[model samples]
Target: MAATIRFLTARGVPVMAHVGLTPQAVNTFGGYRVQGLGDDAERIRRDAGAVTEAGAFSVVLEKVPEPLARAITAEIAIPTIGIGASPACDGQILVVDDVLGMFTEFRPKFVKRYAELGSEAEAAIGAYADDVRERRFPAAEHVYATASKAGDVA
Candidate 1:
């Protein structure tokens, strides 16, 4: 990861390093486990340092312990972005779907739903369907006047 970050940065590409609870490596880690816990703190610390030294402008710490996240943030010169990490990090990130309560396949422990837009959307569509079925839609006020040829209208 550090090597890739370095290569990208060397080519003038801004790199955002991702540490802890890497979703892509979920299989290797045996599931979505929080990283930087207990003895793993040292490893995570090293990872953060390596990433920063590799020229990453920011790093996302996911599902790491709050204290470890704080320490990593302090040790690194770049900004630390937390996902499931801690509020002490420099910043935070969340998926738009998670925030809007649209994607419900599985909810992470850290995600906080701000709105139930999915349910609202479904209700709205059902209402529209009912209106159309009852012939109550396309009411005169909801339609446009047909175009008239020149001089055809008085």
Candidate 2:
């Protein structure tokens, strides 16, 4: 991972490392649960340190204890972006779907939905389906005249 980070940074490509509750490792972690608790905190700390040392411009600390996140943020030279972590982080981020309430499968504890776009989208789709079933769609304005009907054929 450090090699990859170094390679990217060496080429002037900015790298942001994600640690603690990495979504890609969800299955290995047994689910989307908070990481870096108790002894595990040390591992997260080391991961952040390694990434920073390897030239990461920033790191995301996700779903870890507040104190741990804060500690890592202070310890690291690069900025710390928090997701379900401490407010003390240099910046914060949340999944766009979660913010818009478009994803209903699972809601994480840290997600605070600002809008229920999923429900609105469902209602819209239902309305469109009803229109189609009732033959209300494909009204006169919806169809285009063929060349013969438009008297364009020689």
Best by lDDT: 2
> Tens-digit lDDT track for model 2 on 52-72?
999999999999999999999
Q: List TM-score per model, in order.
A: 0.76, 0.83
What's model 1's TM-score? 0.76
Q: Model 1, range 32-137, lDDT digits (tens) per residue?
A: 8788878988998999999999999999999899999999998999999999997989999998888999866778999999997888878899999999999999
Clashes of each: 0, 0
Pull out the clashing pairs in model 1: none
The Cα local distance difference test for each model comes to 0.90, 0.93
**Global local distance difference test of model 2:** 0.93
For TM-score, the strongest prediction is: 2
Clashes of 2: 0
RMSD of 2: 5.0
* Global fold similarity of model 2 (TM-score): 0.83
